[model samples]
Target: MRVRQAKRDQLVAEGVTPYPVTVPTTHSLAQVRADWGHLAAGAESGAEVAVAGRVIFVRNTGKLCFATLQAGDGTQLQVMLSAAVVGADDLGRWKSLVDLGDHVFVRGEVIASRRGELSVMADSWRMASKALRPLPVLHKELSEEQRVRRRYVDLIVRPEARQMVRDRAAVTRAIREVMHARGYLEVETPTLQTVHGGANARPFITHLNAFDLPVTLRIALELHLKRAVVGGIDRVYEIGRIFRNEGIDSSHSPEFTMLEAYEAYGDQESMAELTRELVLAAADALGSRQVAHEQETIDLDAPWSWLPFYDGLSVALGENVSTSTGSDRLRELGKEHGLDLDDDFGPQKMAMELFEALVEPGLIQPTFVCDYPAIAQPLARPHRSSPGLIEAWDLIIGGTERATAFSELIDPQIQRQRLVEQSAAAAAGDEEAMAIDEDFLQALEQGAPPMGGLGLGIDRVMMLLTGAGIRETILFPFVRPQV
Candidate 1:
C-alpha cells in the first residue's frame, strides 16, 4: 500500500496526468493473442500494437523490466520493457510512477521469449489510472465477510469469480434463444407494485414520494404477465428481479433474478416440456447436457421423474399421504419426524413440513413433485381428475426446489376467493401471504384463457450449472453494514 502511494506521489511530482480522462488502446490482451497466433518464436511481428490493462505483476532489473497486465475482461498479458528502446527518462518514470493495479497503455511489438512464452515487447507506455489502495488477497478465498463487501477487488484476483459472470451471461443468451425460437415474447413488468400479489413472500415496502402512497417491491412477476395473456400477448416471458424481504442463505437472496414464463392454452404438462427444454438449453450453453455438482453428475438427458406430492411423501415416510389422510395421522407423522406442527398446522401445511423434511433432501436427482394440495396452491387450478389437488409441480434438483409451475387458476370467482383467503391469512399475521389485488381480479373477469406459468429461480440454476454459491453467481451480493 505504501509503495503504491509513493508511486502516486512520484507521478504527481513528475507533472504527469496520473489518471488521464481518455486512454485509447488498439487491442485487448485477448484479441492480441488471438490475432497474433500466426507469429512464431524467434520472429518479430512487424505490428505496433496498443494495449491497456491493469499492471498485476512487475519485476524490475537495471535496464529491463517485465510486467503482467490484465484487461477489464480478465485477459492477462506479459509485457517486456527495456530502457534501451523506451529511453532512460521514460523507463525511470515507468519504474517510479507505475504500481500494481494502475491502468497502463502499452505500445508494443509481439514476440515470444526464448523460453517460448508469448509476450509484448513495449516501446512506450502511459498511466491511465493510478489505483490508490491495494486489492485484497482473495484469489484463494475471502478471509471473512469481504466476499460481499469487496467483490470488485475479489473479481480481479479470482479468475472463476469473473467466469461465473460470463457463464451466467451465456446461460441467459441460450435461454433467450430458446424462448425466442418458441415464439415467447420477452416482456418487462413493474418492479414496484401496488398490492404485491404474485407469490407468497414478504415484500420490501417503500412510499412513492409523488403519490405519497405505500408501494412494495414485487415479490413475483406472475399477476401482470397473466394480464398480458388476457390482452392477447399469448406467449410471454420475463427475466426480472424479484425482491423478497427474506432470510439470506446459500439458496436465498433478498433480491435475485427470476424467469417467469406463461403460454396461453397451456397447463402443467406444457410447462413441464418447456421447463425441461430450458434446463437442457442451459446445460448445452455450459458445453454439456449434464453438470457435475455435489460429487454427482446430474444427467439432463435422463428421463425426469414426475411424482405426485403425496406419493413422494408416502414413499419417503413409508406411510400413506393423500387427501383422504386424516389430520390425526398427519400429526402423528409430523411428531414421528420431530417436526414443529401444532393445531394451527393444517393437513396441507403438515404435508409440506413432512415432505420438506423427508423428501426434498433425497431429491438430489432432478424430479418433478406434482399435485400440490389445492388449499396450499391458491394460484393453481384444481386438477381435472383430482377434486382437492391443484395441478402444480415444483421442479427439484440437487436437493433444492429450483422452479415452480402450475395450471393457473383463471376463473374470476375462484381467483377472487383465493386472494381473499390469502388476505385473511395476511390479516391473521402472515407477512409472506398475498394481498388481494382488485385489478388482477378485474382482469380475470375479462376472461383470461387457460395458461401455464413457470417461475424459475435464476440464481439457483446458475449455482447448479457453474458449481458456485448463490451469492457467488450474484455480481454484488448484499452484506450487512460494517461497523
Candidate 2:
C-alpha cells in the first residue's frame, strides 16, 4: 500500500496527474477480439488498436514486460510492453506509474507470441485511474457475511459475483420485453404514499418535512396501478421497489424488487398464462430451463398446473380442509405437523399458515395454488362457482412463493366491506392488516374494470435461475452496523 502511495506521489513530482477524468480508447478488448480475432497462431493483423482496462497481472521478462488488462465485463487481454518497441525512456516511467489495479490506456498492434497467445504489443500507455490498495487473491467458498461486507472487492475476485449482475440485467430486460410485447403500458408509481393498502404487511413509516404529515413507504404496487386502471389505462405495469418492515429470511428482504402489472376486463384466472409466460421468459433469458436448489433440481420446462387450495391441503394432511375449517381445527392439524400458531390468528389466517407449512414445501415444481378462502383474499373477486372462495393464485416454485395473481374486486361496496374487515383485524392486533383507504374506495366507486394483476418477486426469480439464496442474488443486502 505504501509503495502504491509513493508511486502516486511520484506522478505529482513529475507534474502529472495520477487520475485523469477520461482516457479515450478506440475499441474495447472484447470488440477487438470479435472483429479481428480470427488471426491464426504466429499471425499479426497489423491493425493498430487502442484499448483501456485495469491492470490485473504484471510480469517482467528482462527485455519485455507482459501485463493482463481486464475490462469491466470480465474481458481480458495480454499487453506486452517492450523496452525496444516503446523506447526505454517511456517504458521506465510507465513502469513507475502503473500498478496492478491502475486503469490504463494502451495503443498497440495485435499479435501472437511464440506460445500462440494473442497479445497487444504496446507502443505507449497512459494512466486513467490509480488505485492505492491491492486487490485480494480470492478463493472459492466465501462465507455470506464476509462477501456482503466486501461486495465491491468480491465482485472483481469472483466471476460468479459479476455474472450475477449480468444475469439480473438480462432477466429484467426479458420481463420488460414480455410485458411490452403483451401490449401492457409500462408506468411508474409513487414510492411514498399517505396510505399503503396494496398488500398485508407492516410498512416503514417516515415523516415529510414539507407537509409535516406522516408518510409510509409503499409495501406493494397494486393500489396505485388500480388507480391507473380507473383512469382508463387498461393495461399498466411497473417494476419497482417495495419496502416491508418484516423479518429477514432466505426468501425475504426488508426492501425488494417487484414486477406488478394490471389489466382491465380480466380475472384472476386470466393472470395464469401471463405468469407462466413471464417465468418462462426469464428462464429463456438465462438460456436454461433447469435449476438446482438444496440437492434437488427444478425443471421449469415441464408444464405447470393449478393446485386447488383446500383440496391440496386435504391431500397433504389426510384431512379435509375447507372454508368451513375452524381456527381451532386448523391449529390442531398444524400441531400434528409440529407447527405452532399464535392464539390471535383467525380461521382464514390459520388455514393459510398451515398450507404454507404442510403444503407449499412439498410443491417443488412450478404450480399455482389457487382459490383461497374469501377471508384470505379480501381484495380478490369472489369465485363465481364458490362464493366462499376468491379468485386468486399463488405461484410457487421450489417450495417458495414466487408471484401472486388475482381478479381484483372492483365493486365499491364489496371492496369497502372487505377493507373494513381488514381494518378491524388491524385494530384487533394484526400489524400486517390492510387499511381502509377511502380514496382507493372512492376510485372504485368511480368504476374500475374487472382486472387481472400479477406481482412477481424479481429476487426470487433470480434465485430460481441462479441456484442462489435471495441475499446472494441481491447486490447489497442489509447488514448490521459495524461495531
Candidate 3:
C-alpha cells in the first residue's frame, strides 16, 4: 500500500503523462564501456547519446553526486552529476525529483572524470519509468538465501550471476542455430494433452473449464514429434517447456525446457552422433571445451564413450543382465539393489531401475549408454540381433542424464503391445508410467516410417555450460510457500 501510494504521488508531482511515447535507444552499455578506457583520454564531446537503464545505487557528495545504472545487456556504468554541469536552472528541479531504482534516459556526451573514471556527462535527462520503492541496496553483507530470492537485485550487484544468465542465453541461441543449420524445422507441440503418454514422468494436472475435461501438462515432446515424423514431417525439433510432478532438488524442476528432435530414416546411432555434435557446437560458443561446475570440470570436447547398457549393468551388478536371464534373474538383481521387483516389474522397469541405481550416476564424463532393454524403452524399436534390447541411447554427463534418444518403433503391432504394457503399469498406481495413446498407435498403423528421436534437457545443458548449480541456472525456479 505504501509503494502504491508513493507511485501515485510520484506521477502527480512530476506531471507525468498517463501514456508515454516510445524513445529510441542508440547503443548498449556494454558497447560503450568496452572501449571506455581508450575513449576516455580523448573523449567525444557535443555528441547526443541516448542511454537508458535502471538506477541501482546513488550517492551524493555535496553539490556533486554519482549513480550506478544497469543497462539491458547486464552492463553496469557509473554516471556522474554535478549541480554546475546540470545547470543552476534545472539543478534544484533535478535534486527534488531524482530517486534510486527509477528507469531513466539520458542524452549525453562521453567524458572522463577527475579520478580518471569513464562517465556520461548529461546534457539532458528524463525519467523513463519511476520505481516507487527503493530496491535492496548493494552491499557485501547480504545472505545467500536473500540474494537468491531477490535475484533481480542480485543480478545488479553480482557479476557472476549476470554472466551466468548471459552465457545461458548464448547457449540457447547456439542450439537453435545448430539445429537450423542442420535443416531441422522448429515446431511447437501441445502443452496440454488429454492423455500424456511420453516418457516416464508424472505430469501436473489441470482442468479446462471450456471443455469440462481434465488435462495434463506434457512431460516430454517425444510422442508428438514422432507423430509428426510419421506424418512425413522429417527433421523436426521443439524447444519447449515440460511439466513433471516430481521432487525438487539441485537437478530437478517442476517445469523446464526440453529440446527434443526427430529425424526420419535415422537410428539411435545417428541420434547419438547428432547429440555429440550439438553439444560440441554449444561448447565452442561458450569459448571453452570444458565447463566448471562445483569442483569438477566437464570436458565437453572429449570423445564421448559408447557402452552397451548390459555392459554397464554387468560392471555395476557383478552379474550379467542379459535378456535371456528371464524375469527371475532380473528380479533377484532388483532385490540386491533394494528395488521392489513386483509383478508389474518387467524386464524394462527392472533394468531401468538397475541402471538408475547403479550405472547412471557413475557416468561422470560424457558417455552414451545404448541398447536399453525393450521393456525399458516402450516406443523404441528392438535391435535386429538382440531381440530383447531396444535401439536406445542415453547421453550421461557429469553424473547426470543429459539426453535420451532412440530408434523409434513404427511397427503398429509392437507399438500397441508396448502401450498396453505401459497402460498396465499406469493402472498399477505408477503415476510416472505412460498411458496408452490410441491416436499415436493409429498413426503408427498408418505406416509411419522408422526414425530416430532425441530429447535433451536444455536446463541441464545450460547448467553445465554456465558452470552454475541447478538452482542458479534457472530463473524463477519454484520454491515452496513460506508461512
Candidate 4:
C-alpha cells in the first residue's frame, strides 16, 4: 500500500493526474474482441479505438510490455505496449505507475501477436483511476466471509460473482417481461408502513419524525398491490425489497427481493399457471430449464406435480392427517418427526411444522402443494370442496418454497375475523403474526374483486436459477458486524 501511495505521489510530482475527470472510450473490451478478434497473426487493423478497464495482469520485458484489462462484465483485453509505438519515456512511466488494480485507458490499433493472440497494440495510455491498495491474488479463492463482506473485490476476482449479478438482472428482466406481457401494471408501494400485515413476519420498526408515529419497513408487497386491484388496476405487480426481522441462513435472509402480483377475478389455479410461466421464463433467461441443485437435477420443463397439503403430510407421516385432526395428535406426530413444537402451537401450526420437516425436503421437482389449512393462510379464501382448507398453493422448487398464491379472501367480514385471530396471536407473543390493518380492511369493505395474489421470493428464484445461496443472490446481503 505504501509503495502504491509513493507511486501516486511521484505521479503528482510529475504533474500527472492519477485520477482523471474523464477517459473517453469508443468500445468496451467485449466489443473490441467481437470486432477485431478475427485478425491473423502479426495483423494490424489500422483502426484506432479507445478502451478503459481495470488492469488485472501486467508483464514488462524492457522494450515490450503486456497488460490485460478487464471490464465490468469480466471481458479481458490484452494491450501490448511497445516502446517503439508509445515512446521509451511513456513506456517507462506505464511500467512504473500502472498497478494490477488501477483503472487505465488505452488508445490503440487492433492487432494480433505473432502467436495469434488478439490484442490492442497501444499507441497511448493514461491512468484513469489509481488504486492505493493492491487487489487479491488472481487465482486465490476468497473465503465465504470475505466474499460477502467485500463483494466489490469478489466481483472483480471471481467471474462467477459477476455472472451472478448479470443472471439476477436477467431474471428480473424476464419477470417484468412476463408480467407486462400479461397486462400487469407494475407499481410501487410505501416502504415505511403504518401497519405491516402483508405476510406473517416480524417487521423492522422505526419512528417517523415528521408524523411522530411508529412505522415499520414493509415485510411484503401484498397489501397495497391488492388495494391497487380494488382501485380498478385489474392486474398489478411489484418486484421490490421486503424486510423480515428474521433469522439468517443459507436459504433465508433478513432482507431480500420479492415479486408480488394480483389478478382480479383469478383464482389459485390461474396464479399457479402464472407462477409456472414466470419460473420457466426466468429459467429460460438463464439459458436452461434444467437446474442442478444439491445433487439433484430439477427439470423445470417437465410437468410440475400437485400435492394437496394434507395428503402430502399424511403420506409423510404414514397416517391420515387433516384440519380436523386434534392438536394433541398433531403434536405427537411432530414429536415423532423430530420437531420441537411449541405448547401454544395449534393443530394447523403443528401440521405445517411437520410438513416442512418431512414433506418439503422431498419435493425436489417443481411442485404445487395446494389446499392448505385455513389457519395456515389467513388471507386465502375457503376451499370450495374442503371444509377447513383454504384455496392456496405454495410452489416448491428444488426442495424450497419459491412462490405462494392464494384465492384472496375479499370478503371483508371473513378477512376481519382472520385478522382478529392473527392480532390475538400477536398480542399473545407470536412475533410472526399479522397485525390488524384497519385501512386494508376498509379497502376490502369498499368492495374488492375476488383476486388471486401471488408472492415469489426473488432471491430464492435466483438461488434456483443460478444454483447459488441466498446471500450470493442478494448483492449486498446483511452480514454480522466485525468487532
Query: Which candidate gets the maximum TM-score versus the true structure?
Result: 4
Off by over 4 Å in 4: none
**lDDT for model 3:** 0.79
Better of 1 and 2 by TM-score: 1
Error of 3 at 87 (Å): 3.5
Q: RMSD in angstroms, candidate 3?
A: 3.1
lDDT of all predictions: 0.88, 0.88, 0.79, 0.92
Tens-digit lDDT string for candidate 3 (386-446):
8778888888887788899988888999889888877888898888889989898888888
TM-score of each candidate? 0.96, 0.96, 0.89, 0.98
True lDDT of residue 24, candidate 2: 72
Order by TM-score, highest first: 4, 1, 2, 3
Clashes per candidate (backbone, < 3 Å)? 0, 1, 2, 0
lDDT of 1 by residue, 101-220 (tens): 888999988887666666889999999999998765434577535756788877788777788888999989988999999999999999988898788899999999999999999999
Q: Candidates 3 and 4: which is better by TM-score?
A: 4
Position 456, candidate 3: lDDT: 86
Q: For candidate 3, list the clashing residue pairs, or say none.
A: 348-375, 348-376
